[model samples]
Target: MSDVTVPPAPEGLPYVSVVVPVHNDTARLRLCLQALAAQDYPADRFEVWVVDNNSDDDPRPALPEDERFQLLRERRRGSYAARNRALPHARGEVFAFTDSDCLPHPDWLSSGVRALLREPRPDAVGGAIRIFFDHGTVPTSGPEHFEAINEFRQRKYVEEWSFAATANLFVDAPVLSRLGGFDATLQSGGDLDFGTRLGRAGGRLIYDDDTVVDHPARSTWRELGRKTVRVANGIADRSAHLGRRDALARAVNEGSGAVTIWLKVWRRNEPAPRRAVEKVRYAAAFAYVRLLRTGVHLGRFTRGR
Candidate 1:
């Protein structure tokens, strides 16, 4: 397939619009753009939009000079907010979302479009995310890795997921508009919140392994810990909006999972006792977040007045 050239959008919207939010990371951004440009999907059937979220290093020059591709600028710091801004400008039946850090397979867009066009017309579709790590890095493992392992193990849940990751997810434009786009306040779990709302509203979400992306898990243990904290914050922020009964159930499940992780850490054989200690510390950090749901609920109750 020839590189997808930017052409004037036809008289009507196309089948798919690939929307990406980019900030900094010019190198990875360039790679992402190039991969999109090389997509095997029919040029006219799909479009690409990159919302540059106030990045100091611009990534336009690296992309093809085709007009079919749009490089817009938004000063917002939040990825979901940037996505909201771009949605109004999109002209496609389906909205496909992915992150700038991910590199999609050539058939990704084609596969996603096909999945949505399935007999019943799935309301949403998600592709698998395979993690790649830097070579020669210390072979040490951390709590975050274990959590990510859980996520990987749960990838099958995507076929029937109430939550979806924006990194490799797609949705029908009308349904997305009805949901009011992505939630702006969430720093990390906005995708999950969006998917949950859609699913609860009778939308169908399907997982397609054929459409895949390469996700590089860069950053050290400290960075991973910080990320876990941000994820916990997102959970807290979205708890009330998730409905009271659901929120309570989720809190209980998270608490149980945390305990299970700690027990596993204690029982596992470790060459050094410090490894066990570190796991306990990380597990506690996550457990404390399980209890933070009370604060989130209190805030919601006070705001209801």
Candidate 2:
């Protein structure tokens, strides 16, 4: 079937397990739950699994008292680990992954499942994500602007790198089991690693621009800083199996390239000075992330020295 509006079927629909991993971000998680609850998909065909990854406070109370939603906790302290905790318990033909802070479209599940059920079925599907700001029409802060230009380019990631962010990804349940699920050691970029493995295993991956979700942008420098550190550390962890030096070099180069990439794709038609200001904001954020990555690699390399 082509990418068209998929209608709800009365019977023969496959079961779906929607998995989410959340930390202390309760406010946004509430919205995410509401979105899931409002899905157009039949309740009996889909189940929601919200795995709390050792939040500072138990998120059980946050979960609505509904049988369709189950509360699972993973003390291992990572989103991927929390997801793994739900893997064995997930009783579905398809596994849908989304972030705790994401507001998936009402048709998200139906569209994803429809794509998977096509004649030449895909092993995985990467959906579209729209980055949203809490206040103002445009980004109000440096972090928000930086994220606006850099984050949630899921389309580019899927088409160029053959990987999809877990914020809106769907995969056949058996494919995940065959690949041994996500690498639990990674705190970030787990989606990329998992998707790359799928590609290498000759698994068919599809990019569906119609399947959509909304993710809130980071509004504060501190929030962006924390994310930068987490991602950099994840890169360090992944480099342990692959050569650390090579990965570290790649990270450094990617950071430098981010500056140029932003300039080329950003508002170029604007007055030169205004465009320059935007470039500065993007450069500052990219520099901070680069420095954090360097520190992480140095720390990992000099462990006992």
Top TM-score hit: 2
lDDT of 1 by residue, 1-305 (tens): 11333354455334677888988877897788788888988777777888988888977876678776888787767788878877877777788999898899898888877778788778888878877655532223443343444444326657555666788988888889889898876677788788788888998888878778877664355555556556665765656566656655655666676566566656656221256555665555445444454444444445541
Clashing pairs in 2: none
Candidate 1, pairs of clashing residues:
6-68, 7-68
- lDDT of candidates 1 onward, in order: 0.70, 0.82
lDDT of 2 by residue, 1-305 (tens): 11222344479788888999999988888889989999998888888899999898767766777898998889897899899988888887889999999999999999999888887989999999999887956776667777887788998999998999999999998898899999897888899899889989999888898899998899887889899889877777766766656665655675565555456535557322255576667666666666666666666656621
RMSD after CA superposition, every candidate = 6.1, 5.2
* Span of 10 residues, lowest total lDDT, candidate 2: 1-10
Per-prediction TM-score, please?
A: 0.74, 0.87
